[model samples]
Target: MRTATSIDVVDHDRRRLLRGALAITVAGAAGLLPAYPGVAAGGDAIRPFRVNVPEEDLAELRRRVLATRWPDRETVNDQSQGIPLAKIKPLIAYWGTGYDWRKAEAKLNALPQFMTEIDGVDIHFIHVRSKHPDALPVIITHGWPGSVFENLKVIGPLTDPTAHGGHAEDAFDVIIPSMPGYGFSGKPTDTGWGPDRIARAWAELMKRLGYTRYVAQGGDWGSPVSSAMARLAPAGLLGIHINLPAIVPPEIAAVLAVGGPAPAGLSEKERATFDAFIAAAKMGNRTYAAMMGSRPQTIGYAITDSPAGLAAWMLGHPGFTHWTYDSSDPEKSPDEVLDDVTLYWLTNSAVSSARLYWEYDGGRSPAFAAGEKTAEISLPVAITVFPGESYRAPETWARRAYRNLMYFHEVDKGGHFAAWEQPELFSTELRAAFKPLRAAK
Candidate 1:
């Protein structure tokens, strides 16, 4: 779920050719769920939204799946070509016959969810409060191909910060919001509202909840959003902690970037780190990011409606991401990955979610840098890198912007979805990283 980096997940030219048709789908409307009033300034504090992703939407997906105009598969290797027909057909059968959206909806309803407008969009987030009187307000952000479901496991550790051997001062009032064009939030009709816009809106949201100051944390897309929150210096944003840092060395931009030459002007540590990141990304979790960046909506039909299609689309994930798939250390089961993807489908938010990538890739998102900024943050920033994530900037590069850097952690077990895969370790690092701020307060 940690997604600041969006590298090509496939061999470039082949991926490029696949976008011709799918690119068109990104522009058109796919999931037209009810839009809450964009201009509402004073609605009820908590507008109840259980996951009743309408039956009309479900029917639409089913119809499309049955009528799916099958694509011809490239021979042999599944790597070069797009999702294979051999895999997709059976998955469709399962989605229609076996996948259960109502059950998922019931589970979501069990959490405390509320919607409030910030910057003309209806922000849907789960605002979970602890029994503890004083809980630190912590907002969780998800990246593309992900939703609020990323941190569903960490809810326990985050809410009950004390029981997890952390201080009562560390207890968090958790807020997990659906990003723009992703889940319940409005698919931005215009371009300007990107991650920074989302971050600013989030800051406003915390203030609306009556907190003068609070902490921010996220991985993947959430990482940048949280970074933007710190960068914006919004009221009460105490400190920001993230899973990954999208690094761009301005001085030697050519040498270290993805397609750049071998890194030059580097210390041994920096060189080793850079090489490791490049190597991992090439070997692990590359395709999904490539497809999303190129033409997210190209295959929207599969993800949005066919439950089986959705599962097959991300079937390699939990194992590819969590250690369990290969058993290195930290891992999660297939059920967990299925649950996250299914949430999007059951709620019929798949295409809308993919649209975020289209808009972001289209240069519409704010948090994603134009080229990469001069690591301009002054507040304390902490980064936790996981195994499946493939890359973690070395301290030398990471320190360029985070001048007041407090912690740099690298764990071996988990992959991209840290909170889901290793909540205990993740929560531990979070409490420790923010300890200075919590102590000050």
Candidate 2:
């Protein structure tokens, strides 16, 4: 997931009015009301959608790639400056000559993709119903620098556990939505489309889909959204399982913010984790967060226009590639990373996506900020802390953060992009985390 900036909050009432009008327009076009089906005479409709970028569009993307103005090499020998030119050159070469968007499109179209209006934005999602009659419904969200593509690898294993190693009862009917302003989803013209609002939209979305009972799962930005969903505790929200659990305690966050050392009484492991986070922060590795949160629109012009620029911007983030398996190996390929960048480029969502950063405080990481403001999630909460993640919250912090921590485990493999990096492991974690919730409403 990629995030940098947060747009300053605008008036909520005005944004609501605009969304209401959009809802009416969408509803009338589909011969339905903007409200959920059960609540009104005319109900909102979920329409099937296809990913079909015209040939000319693909050609233009290629043309833009070949026409890019090359930049001089950095003064440093390594990534100390940023993504080296050597790393980006081959990626652009493959993107221009070899990569096939059609393959990606076919993969998505093969699944059940749909579009629906939710709080004014047209939410695009893949809804795959499990063959198992008793399969649980789960809405999985993608993070920034990511799209529905991030969760694609796990779709089959999750929805058809029988085909994998699990029994029929472990199946999950998956719902992976492109966040508003990302990928095929409609962008918010006004402000106020942050994770909190997105959570409400998710709740309304599940209800509209006729799913009165469901659980939520996500990592990276997905974690914050899922956390919000759990906090909102919507009717019939079974529980939430997050790989990147945003469970940093507030005192630790305050200390880190001030460049102060870890509090005096922490254990060796807990203190070491906090110390590592502070060290990374001081290294200026997360400057992108400050930039995006403060001035996403300004940076948007460059990223939106330049394909290489967009790719590098994404790669510049630490632990993003580790989201891919064997990311550290020199023999590792850039296929998955290119796929993510291509989606952002084709969608022209550089600026729109960056605006997501503007919704919160500029300096702090979203995970820590999430801890500071979010109320303790009293419902069942499960967490999987992967070793490769930038911040692997100690169990102590997680328990303090989540009032009802049903499950917590430290997986040997995977990273920030856990689900995408290790689908098999990711799927197994979900099956175990939500097993108890299966019997609930």
Candidate 3:
């Protein structure tokens, strides 16, 4: 275990006593939360935002984590049962005692963060413009169990490519937005905030940002939102790049749905991918998706109330568990994992974020479904298959699924959270993936 780092603490006992008075005033009998300070009173105003988690909230989070009741270790030593108790215990201990949410908060505030209203929800985003001339504008989205924190590492490299072993031409004006119900973004008080709606809001967001031509990228939930934007084919959207592309043929998907063998005529890579998907399904790897899609509110109760429970639940994600969690590996550090889990805890967005699964037609949407048609997407599409991803998307299927396939390459590293796990490699892939689209710009 890595030695715990200390944080400089200022006594906020007085502020804690007056915390209720600092709460935003309710607008009316409907009890609407007040608009953030500096946000204009009217429509389409993009206001600067900063992360300032209350010190008391952090204190209470640590208290909850330390107060957690122990669950007996799983009968098996492996992770087949779930995140093993031994693995989570140390991580939770660090989260309670060693982790500093202020560091993560400071990292976020170091960047250019902003909030804007889109489709009745206040969306939080990080907007960074490259110094290079004619830098291509690209909107990137984060997935479940992740917040904008996932993309933090790649921002500097992508936005300023020259300094990161790439040409100025590779520079990108990056737009990373927190999904409607995730991070600092306002949670939806009603239904209808699915990927399609989120996609439209992203398009509007780019237009409002004055980017007449832009591209998009995503993995996990971001995949569907970006794909939806492709389907929308909004005028400014030049193309899209997805690390997690849904390219399985309907025939193959149907067979897998029933736990059948791989269909015939698949290439070795395709067959391997097919087998992997079948194996994952049998292993109950997607049980989390099923639970969140069906009854997010039910499980939300436990995760929302218990900080340790929340950390364990989020760490159960295949992306986090599969990563090398050694303290020496900065990219896959446990602190980084806790950063994401802590964000969910601080914002009380466990239920709101899970609801995105519910909104995806109980997880039957094309994003989660393997065999959905990709013909509706008239715009150019690019894909990068990371070796550690849940399922390797075969080139054959990718070409077939994306009619106007512009780029497809398999990289040696990274996984479902490719950008988070391998930011430099992920940034390089983006530079190459969107190179062709740059000509259009």
Best model per TM-score: 3
Is 1 or 3 the stronger prediction by TM-score? 3
- lDDT (10s digit) by residue, model 1, range 1-441: 322232232112222322221221322322422233222345524354445555655565566556665556758664434445665565455555555555656667788666666665567788777778767778889875567766777888878976777767777778888887665555454555656788898887777767776789988778778887877878778888887675545544444344445555778866765576455445544556556556766777656555556655665442333223221332343344445665565445566565555545552322122232425666778877676664555666666657767888877766667786778788888877877776544
> Which prediction has the highest lDDT against the true structure?
3
Worst lDDT run of 10 residues, candidate 1, spans 13-22
Q: TM-score for model 1?
A: 0.76
lDDT of each: 0.62, 0.78, 0.82
Ranking of models by lDDT? 3, 2, 1
Cα deviation of 134, candidate 2, in Å = 1.0
TM-score, one value per model? 0.76, 0.88, 0.90
Looking at model 3, which ten-residue stretch has the lowest summed lDDT? 2-11
lDDT score of model 3? Answer: 0.82
What value of lDDT does candidate 2 attain over all alpha carbons? Answer: 0.78
C-alpha root-mean-square deviation, each candidate: 10.0, 6.3, 8.1
Better of 2 and 3 by TM-score: 3
What lDDT tens digits, residue by residue, belong to model 2 across residues 51-93? 6666766788899888878899888876668777866787788
Query: Which parts of model 2 have CA positions greater than 4 angstroms off?
Result: 1-43, 321-332, 369-374
